[model samples]
Target: MEAKLWFILLCSVVALLLYVIGFWRRKAGEAAFAAARAAATAEDRDRYCRLAVMAGHREACKMFCLARSDFFEDHRPLEPFKSHGIKVVFYGYYYPSRYTDLLNEEQRAFCRSLYQFKEGENHGIGFFKACMSALKLDDAPYHIMFMPCSDEFKYARRFKRLDWYIRTHRKGRTSGLYDVDVFEPRDSLHEAKGGENRILERNYRITGDIKGKQVIIVDDVLTSGQSMADYKEEIERCGGKVVAAIFYGKTVSVPPMLLVKAVVWGGYIKTG
Candidate 1:
């Protein structure tokens, strides 16, 4: 009992410390960013700008974008897996190996920015264009939808930018597509962990119509699959059919399949 109490106290202290640090960092970041804008010397300005970015300032972070062509590799298929009785497609594996760890991290960061920022829309469109070319969704009555985020602004930005790319890019890919907007957020809620249980026990309300449409959920990563399962159940409960789930990658310690595929494609990751 004494040890447990001590552990609890330690955890609380750590959490409080982290919270305080985060608050300080945000303030520092904003100030540094302002200083960078006002600095007369280029060196001092660059230094302050870097500090702001490192401190996680929103505007400062925007000035920097992660894009390295070498990070591009074969992304998709994953042998047509299933999640909660719905077909799933994993475009790539978000793994960092010994040989190409930095590249992998940069690649993951760039990929994540797809849904997080508007600039990523172009990349996201091309990324999906390649995936769409690879997929024979001719027979599937698919409607694009993203993994529902309670943050309405983020969700709205994400789907709006990426969803219509296929439709506008070419005539063939626009056969029977719709922006599946059956659901709307009630209020903001923290996205807690626990995957399925977290989703099942959430406080925010999601109201939707469904209309018996076949949904294709787009997400950044595919992890333990429970979250998708919960999403699948939620979609079903709301009266829509989950035809497929598309992802940028699956998280893994070592991406054996990705390496194998890369080699078979007549090339490997060029570390140069």
Candidate 2:
């Protein structure tokens, strides 16, 4: 009986030791992650603010201030506007939300470890760096216009976010100016299926005048060209031309013809 009791006690002690080790490791890992995230957030703020100061963009300075303070608090997933702006200047494409999914496990792990967004945010500082590293800012266009996002939220907050990022970062070197008021989506047909029928119902009307302006349409995803095409037609009707369309992801679940005219993350890949 004493021998059996000793064996049981030994087993219990081993199990307890294992549990303590695991608990310690978990806490250590969490602490490391938190520290890394804090560092990244600080770095992003400095980089963005420095760029804004160099460019002499008034609106960007305002955004930098907002980002620093806790005044504006929305938890929804935010898009990486810096990458979108930078990509538009060079390759006309930005990193997609799922772009990391395509990378090898090690590369993906590195990305996840390095970049972290605040609660309810999607991509983080790492995504912005990836996009910014693609090209030099001097090559960006003088006159850049942002297209409205989908019609779901009624306020077009995402579209406004993108517009804010571009206006602040691009810094318009030439005398030519940047305009954010052009297109506004009157309906939310993005989630609907089928082709031009849904696009017809989308009703993305021109709220502000785009007459005689060369527009650059930016969106999170480009599935069918219908919405963009519609925007182009309306802009043209008002004597404005659709100079280029920029998107983070071009979904490949659609027909092949649609991808031909669009520019998305890495250009050609199945996003479905």
Candidate 3:
């Protein structure tokens, strides 16, 4: 009986030691993650933010989403505006480089992150996906299409997120992903970036049957209203009705003070 008691006591002691080790290890890990998240520079935060986001840390994930009311709050949805004639809904206005400097440090960092996301940064896909949620689109059997790309979208990560958002937004109930065969242009139309809009022709052949479908057009930025106009015409020409067009930002040429006034008018700043 004493031998059996000794064996049980040994097993219990071993288990207790393991539990204590595991507990302190977990606490140490959490402390390390917190330190990384609170790093002074965005560059440092970015290095660890990826690991936190992948680990599903809620606070760390907040950096990659604009769902915060104090930041990129939802605007009045589905309001028609501008000359394009499509219902334009955007998260916020994108300012020029000089104007961007006026924002506070955190806000400026976010703006930089957004541009980085646009330039095909992989870890920034969450921001793009969060932008898509601003449209308040209902699961009413609507189709999704991205604007035509001459080759694979220069921002291919953002393109794939567009597809992923719609499909999972309502749990497997949306599709009509905008894909097109890359039409070799006559020459490198560098001006496709803007300054000369519709004069340069794009030979994008949209695929699949979008006939009689209500399509939602997705794009990075809406500027000059020309690319969107062309896409709208193409979808209509193919018998698809564009119900709404959503963008990450609309180019606004406001002076710095006016932009600051607009944000102040929003009453979205956090004070604690």
Candidate 4:
């Protein structure tokens, strides 16, 4: 009986040791991840602030001062505004709510004055409102353009979190190749498909009275930039000047020249 008891005790001790080792390793891993994330956040914050400064946005200095902590968490990097004398607008996909209450009246006025665009309904304009509110900014004259990219459907499927469709369709000839072909011909096809005002239900809503203004086009990513080109043409036709364009991510291939200026991070990092 004593021998059996000794064996049981030994097994129990080994199990406890194993559990302790696993727990320690898990904690260490979590700590390492946290450290890396913090470092990345700091890097992104510095890059954003530097870009804003380079763009000659005096308001950026104050905006960063008020919202640096939150900005760090958001992981958005800033791009230098190309136009020297004109107002440098910081366009983004969505605004975060946390910044609303933090902004002073003057800061709020500035945000309000800036032209802003949200991509789509699902892209989360509410978050922008939250950020505005947190910054204590009142409503500005912002235009919300809801242009859903034609490839958005395919891109959504390609990069979906749980890709059951991809798995199921693996055996069959994939739609992936078709998407590639479409993208290749996207420029000419998109141009023929009504060009600028094709997607606009009421182009007058956003296009009216934009004449001679140095409009900065903003989007989440810049792959082929065909969509941007279309938008730029439309804007120009409506008497708006396409001074610059900014995207969260950039591609290496040919970019649309109409933008005159552009900025992007090479790879993926959450901007909105």
Alpha-carbon RMSD, candidate 1: 14.6
Better of 2 and 3 by TM-score: 3
TM-score of each: 0.48, 0.39, 0.54, 0.26
What does candidate 1 score on TM?
A: 0.48
Number of the predicted model whose TM-score against the real structure is largest:
3
Could you say which candidate leads in lDDT? 3
Q: Please provide, for model 2 over 127-236, each residue's C-alpha lDDT reduced to its tens digit, 9 standing for 90 to 100.
A: 33333344333445434444444443432434444344555654542111233332445544444544326636433445555566555555444544566666666667
> Compared with the true structure, what per-residue lDDT tens digits does model 1 show for residues 65-150?
11111233322344466666767766555532222322324455654554343323544665565555455467555656566555
Question: Residue 248 of model 2: what lDDT?
Answer: 41
Candidate 3 lDDT tens digits, 1-272: 99999999999999999999877755554554575556677556544543444444444344433222233433332333545787777655554454442333655665576576466563433544454455566666777787654455553555665566557754634555545554564332322444435463666777778898888777766656677788899889988898887766655433233333344333324321
Preferred candidate (lDDT higher): 1 or 3: 3
Name the 10 consecutive residues with the lowest summed lDDT in model 3.
64-73
For every model shown, the clashing-pair count is: 1, 0, 0, 17
Model 1 lowest lDDT segment of ten? 62-71
